[model samples]
Target: MIGLTGSPYGSSFPYAREGSFYLSGYKGAAIWFAPVPLFDHSGVVSTFRQLELTKTKFGSIIKLHLLSLALLIVFSFIFYALIWKLAPIPSGAYPFVEKMWPLQATMETIWIKSTLPGGADVVGRLIRWEYISAGMVFTTLLYGGLMVLKAPPLLFYGLIAGLGTGAWIHYTLPTFIGAMLGKFYFSKKYGEKRWRAYAPVILAGYGCGLGLIGMAAVSLVLIAKSTSQILF
Candidate 1:
């Protein structure tokens, strides 16, 4: 392979760089992306109108939402006043994270997935994600309905609703089975309190392991490359 300044080799790739790979997929989601303010009642009203939801119905939802927000603010002040809130980025780490600002602001993925038609599936899954709020409500109501039938065990209602939701069976099944097994078997063999304390550490270790493995594989490739050498 040849190396040249500014991809004078007539090719440049940025989205595939470290930490950018997965966030790169977000470009496909922005096909018609529109940035909106946090509280965009006009947009909601327009969507409801298009959906033919009665003004009264949407008005009720708006009222309920505002009421919930008010109650949240009130209860948060009352209950969590003692808790401290910090900026999302820590001062010490801000310098490192700030380096990605330009890339984060960009949208172009530059045909990274052009060869794979399945990239369209990624876009569809992302578009479907807009329904998460609705899906959650639907899932809750469905599970509650199962409860009204005097379902034998309440825990299994999750399996029913989760499967009913689009393509989440792969997710919900593993979680349900793992949680059941963990609570019934693993918690007994391994002390629950100790496991709870160590769970985050274990997950962090697993993530670091994956990152190291990827980097190691890339390092080996670079070492094996018999390319033109760079001089200091």
Candidate 2:
């Protein structure tokens, strides 16, 4: 008889058991099983050994690790951009926004909880919203910058990518958009129903889009300063 053992990473079955098992997680699920025994007892063991070796190969493992790392970096950058966009930029006189961009982004994430349904209770939704918001911001910023820099092709690409991502997230994860739209509907139908309630959310959601505007303003200022210096 064959025995099966569950390791911290995966489940392993002895060569004698010619069958399969299943694995499940947040991302998805898969079935893992041993191939059918080909020969006598010794051959069966050898096949199992080969299968295990293939699974644990250094190159394959390394490739998977690198792919995971790349994905993590991409997601993190997107999240960072999103939070940065959501947070309020310090006033020109305050001098803090420029210094504490990351902190401001984090604070904006926290602020989102208050605005969301059930406030702090909906932690999952808050986290998802944060990611989605971040993605939106990053895309907008990239496209907007291209536009300001007079790189029409790059701007067009960015616009396509950003809007596509936003649309996908909106349609695929309607719960998030639904919550936001519901909030808007209710606010308009019941609460203050003024532009103020919607304006803050729009400003927060602008992410990279708003950043591009700031970038353009800075670029103009720099150009003006350079022209003045040249004239003098």
Candidate 3:
């Protein structure tokens, strides 16, 4: 129940996948269960023996974790230094922008809502300009984090996810264009009255066609890459 509902930051309900029931909470916390026995009687005893051996090695484990944490801090500092060095030197443009009252007020509001402690309730609203600013900030941070860690693009959805409603603007534009075209076509082919109902359907169909084509192109690229690697 705690795993299912308590950890709202990033929690998952207990779910069955393959032979296991998996539950996760917050960041890296997780619990999993396998219904089927993973080991025979002898194997279970061997596992117990291995557990006993682990007790004696606990100090080594602690040392290894500390070393890993130290390395992570070192790498983070290095990345920060590199980013600072590579950053463009500020020009007179900074002072020019700073003097603009409207722009300065807007920047102050964004900074306070984003950085300060309070304003959680306001920010939690479904839609707001604050959300858009937060999205942009998070996306930039995520990109830098991925670069530092040299992680895969498997979490590419994260970039889109953070953008909230803004992410759909591109997709929405195409659909709107399709809807306009559909309205005209339907009005001409059927009747002016019927276009209201049929116009949206055309856009839906148009969007689906585009999505399928995109998926197919991506899949073909992945398949070709895999096939080449296998052959070589």
Pairs that collide in candidate 2 are 82-134, 141-208
- Whole-structure CA lDDT of model 2: 0.51
Per TM-score, the best of the predicted structures is 1
TM-score of each: 0.32, 0.17, 0.24
- Writing each residue's lDDT as its tens digit, candidate 1 over 1-232 gives 0122111222223223322434444433333233533332334545566547543665777798899999999977853332223224424324555566546544333233422335533433444555867867876786577779877543343344445442366766786787787788867888898777776687799899999999898556544442456799
Clashes of 2: 2
The better candidate by lDDT, 1 or 2, is 1
Ranking by TM-score: 1, 3, 2
lDDT (Cα, tens digit) per residue for candidate 2, span 1-232? 1222111111122222211211111121112122444443533565557658778675775697799999999988975675445445454532566668778666545444433445562334434667768867986787677868888553354345334533466543764565576577756675755655775577577876889999898657545533533454
User: Where does the lowest 10-residue lDDT sum fall in candidate 1?
Assistant: 1-10
**Global lDDT scores for all candidate models:** 0.52, 0.51, 0.51
* Better structure of 2 and 3 per TM-score: 3
Any runs in candidate 3 off by more than 4 Å, and if so which?
1-169, 182-185, 200-204, 229-232
